[model samples]
Target: EHGRGPCDCAEFLVTLVERLTQRIERHWNGIDDLADDLEEAVLDEAGPEVGATLVDLRRQAIILRRYLQPQRDALRALQTGQPAWLESDDQRHLAEELDALERVVEDADAMRERMALVRDELNGQASERLNRNMYLLSILSAVFLPLGFLTGLFGINVAGLPGTGEPLAFWIFVGALVIVAALQLAVLRRMRWI
Candidate 1:
């Protein structure tokens, strides 16, 4: 609203700044709550949902920072009476609002850093779990490799296959397979491969 006099203009600007400060603080409080929850989710549990939440929070913080920085600079200019219209007392009130705006900007920046740290930690946990699963799979494959080759070799048809003609050949081969398995287990144990 355009004011009729300098006094009216000062009052108008001060009221406007106070309202803006309140709105920014409300949004900042919401961000603070989310940051607290995100921190807890990152620290206490695997929090499968936290990754998505973090992404959303980071995006919001970035957007807030982008928008708030310019507004804060404008407020600073108003506080210094860059337009030569604000009285000294009005400038002082604007300075208080500017401080609040600056605080909101800093809080947004801090929130972004916090979300990034949580994201990095979650990624590290996922990588560790993946590595563990891969290691277990490798161990199982190692244990089965030789046994498969032995069985495959015996199954091959040949003119002089040792176990093909005898009645006890099946039992003998079974026993030999058990021995091979035991030997493999022993070697794996010795080498700490198990």
Candidate 2:
């Protein structure tokens, strides 16, 4: 039955802190779900959407941190009863609210760090996949380069190609081409390039 005084102030602070706590917990849960999705996508070799989601989560954490920090300070001030409007019981409730606010702040920082880690992991995975694709492409190009050159040289129209005059020259040319391809394969296998 204490009119608009310390008890009222304390109750208001408690309600505010409780609401803030619930909101922060909800946001934290959302971040956790996003992180789970990101981890799965990274493992599956999925595209960059996971990175975007992580960026969003980081942004959320940053905004929450900025908002929570001052609120936490204010709650701590209330706990100290600088205005002398808080009774002992009011101070206790204010202390509990301050603690909750501190927790929210910590959770915001932790979520931000987690988002950064996930972003880095996604970047590393993307880079690794790109490197692997490039490596495979380079190997294919290397294997085909000689074959392309040989075919280009022989396919050119000429007055006197060495193998053009004989009936069995076509078969012989094909056999030579097969041999060249086999040699390339064997060398690639030996070098562990394939």
Candidate 3:
């Protein structure tokens, strides 16, 4: 009804590219926010969920870049090729769109890199925590190993265990175990393992 012709195609394309660029910019901002959250989550030890969110964000960034690159390239070509149908004004508008697209693509790439760094930091923290936990467990096992052995030796129902006949043997054995634990702790402290 408006009697628009093929010459208007350039205007339509420009508008479409502008809308797409805006959407991509919004996505970039969201990814930026997520990156910030990931850093905070890492510091708080927020666990596997943060990792999953990072993975999703990385995937989104990759997909955005993947799509945006071709659009940017097409826009560049459209501006340079200058099809006979496109007026100088159309070419100018397309050039502006191309610039916007290029910026958004760069933003996507930068966001991906930022997410990668966050992932590495998260992995480092998790590894450190695991190592610390293992160290504590090893120390506990060392302290208990001798105590366990003593109990096992006395528990055997074989011939005359000297403590078996004495009413105070159990108390003595308990005291002995406590002393052993205390000694182990002292040794650990001296070695600075604690």
Candidate 4:
């Protein structure tokens, strides 16, 4: 036995990387839930970082994937009697965990997809509301169009007009406008178009 702590051997980096990979597997699964929550803002804690948290989860998942390759290879080498001491059961557990973490990757993918869909839906709803508001405003403006046209045409004509030559012209003109307005309202009501 070289007796310098098995990892202190020439394969230290390889061993360390492998061990890190196993640990990474554990946290990988946690990332999945984090991503789901981030995407849905399912929990309020995610706050403004919801998107950023999902992005981070994806980034971590990718990193974990890269580590898993070398980790599995290292484990295989150990299994083939390459390591000075390979605890099969522990390694098996680590491998199982690694396998489980793969699901996390899949879940994160699903989460991002759902989040994108939700964002699009929210945008569509907002756009629809905006369009409806614009339409109503335009309709109201259209309804007032006649008033504007009537005021502009008769307002600037102070001379040579039917009402400009008579003493009771102003009263008669007002009376005529009231009758016209009443008739317009009655017609609108009859047509159920008011």
Each candidate's root-mean-square deviation in Å?
Answer: 3.4, 3.0, 2.2, 6.7
From the highest TM-score down, the ranking of the candidates is: 3, 2, 1, 4
Residue pairs of candidate 3 with colliding backbone atoms = none
Better of 1 and 2 by TM-score: 2
Clashing pairs in 1: none
Per-residue lDDT for 144-192 in model 3, tens only?
9999999999999998889788899999999999999999999999999
On residues 147-189, what C-alpha lDDT tens digit does candidate 2 reach at each position? 8898888899987888788999878887887888889989988
The local lDDT score (0 to 100) that residue 19 gets in candidate 4 is 65
- Candidate No. with top TM-score: 3
- Which residue runs does candidate 4 get wrong by more than 4 Å? 1-87, 165-194
lDDT of each: 0.84, 0.78, 0.87, 0.58
Instruction: Please give, for residues 95-144, the per-residue lDDT of candidate 4 as tens digits.
Output: 55455444444554565566566455445655777898997776556555
Q: Where's the lowest-lDDT run of ten residues in candidate 4?
A: 42-51
At residue 43, give the lDDT of candidate 4. 34
Candidate 1's displacement at residue 72, Å, is: 0.4
Report the lDDT tens digits of candidate 1 across residue range 1-194: 67553458778878877987898799879988988988887888655888888899999999988999998988876756556677778777888888898888999988988888888889888998899999898877777888799889899887788868899998998898889788877988899877
lDDT of 1 at 149: 91
Estimate TM-scores for all models: 0.84, 0.85, 0.90, 0.53
Angstrom error at residue 37, model 3: 2.0
